[model samples]
Target: MKSSMHNPHLAPEKYGIMDGISECIVTTISSKGPNAAPMGIIKNSNGIKIRVFKGSKTYGNIMNFPFLAANVVYDPKIYTMTTFSNLERSQFDTIVYEDVEFPVLKDGISWMLFECNNLQKSSQSLVADLIPVKAKLSHIDAVRAPNRGFNSVLEACIHATRYQLTGSQKYLDLMQYHAEIIRKCGGKTEKEALDQLYRFMKTNK
Candidate 1:
């Protein structure tokens, strides 16, 4: 199907998305309310795709509404929070289209609102092709040097989330290895984020 969004090329460029896997905080409407989760959006020559597992809230929300907003944020705390638990309502800013209120992170650097064009489902997950319908460049001047600590925190958080879903010992081991790197290289934010992740994991168990 032809894209209904205008100037899609320009928006992706402005969002710093290219032909690779961009990790984002994707927000969608849930029966309870707005929900957010960490998702990897794949942008390739074929186009953008995201695989949402069948059991996830994201998958259910998309099946119900077929729209999402992918927020580009660098805050490790936000990632940790969303991965492990629900984000506070105060953390979101709403954008309405077609009478639907979509949540955008308050600290997001950029965001892309997408309509699910074609969804191919399996027993495990739904692989949806995305069409960018709207976008915003929230901050043009936010820049930071690469921090290994921050990167490690993200890696650990991913494993933590996986561990929760699968109860896999392998993911737990991976999180432990990444924790060492966070200790050696991460700053205050990375350390605190990891701490929160661990706390959430333990309490939820």
Candidate 2:
């Protein structure tokens, strides 16, 4: 049987979490308050994994707290905004898991609570092989359709991040992919996204 909106590709949804897609929003409280950062979570034969950058607040939180609550969310625009602007929007949920206040998506259909069983640090990033202590879904209104807004933003951000490594090939590929989505879902749904990508390509070049 086909799983709802089953992606033909192995790498989950463009912006959100999907099977084989390793992503998480790192939220932790310091002496000040709470901070949220995006992370890439993975799954392998052994267990689940999370990758964090070196010298980042997310890195510090995972190190100090050593336990984290991961949420599978459906907001690609937020991810893009955070990645490009390094800012957190006001629309998110914070809950107490274990001894920490975990940031979650209020609209997400599910949530996972994991204890940091293994934490690996390196010169470039942090990789944690987590052990799932508890996990379940919080039923909401999520369906099996792709979020056009998130897809567009993710397409733009991924292109922006990979421009140097891939060069013109990446730019062309990204623009063309985005253009196709615009044609299908209609540009009205992705006006802001299109503008952002265009501005970056023009100014950054």
Q: After superposition, how far is residue 27 of candidate 1 from its true place, in Å?
A: 0.5
Pairs in clash, predicted candidate 2: 22-41, 23-41
Per-candidate Cα RMSD to the true structure, in Å, reads 2.2, 8.2
lDDT of each: 0.86, 0.58
Q: Which stretches of candidate 1 lie over 4 Å from their true place?
A: 1-9
Question: What is the RMSD, in Å, between candidate 1 and the native fold over all Cα?
Answer: 2.2
**Model 1 alpha-carbon miss at residue 40, Å:** 0.3
Q: Encode model 1's per-residue lDDT on 124-204: one tens digit a residue.
A: 999998888878898999988989988898899889878988999999999999999998999998999989999999998
Question: Each model's TM-score, in the order given?
Answer: 0.92, 0.67
Highest-scoring model, TM-score: 1
lDDT of 2 by residue, 70-150 (tens): 666555544555444444435557766444465555655565655665577788987876655444467654665765655
- TM-score (C-alpha, index-matched) for candidate 2: 0.67
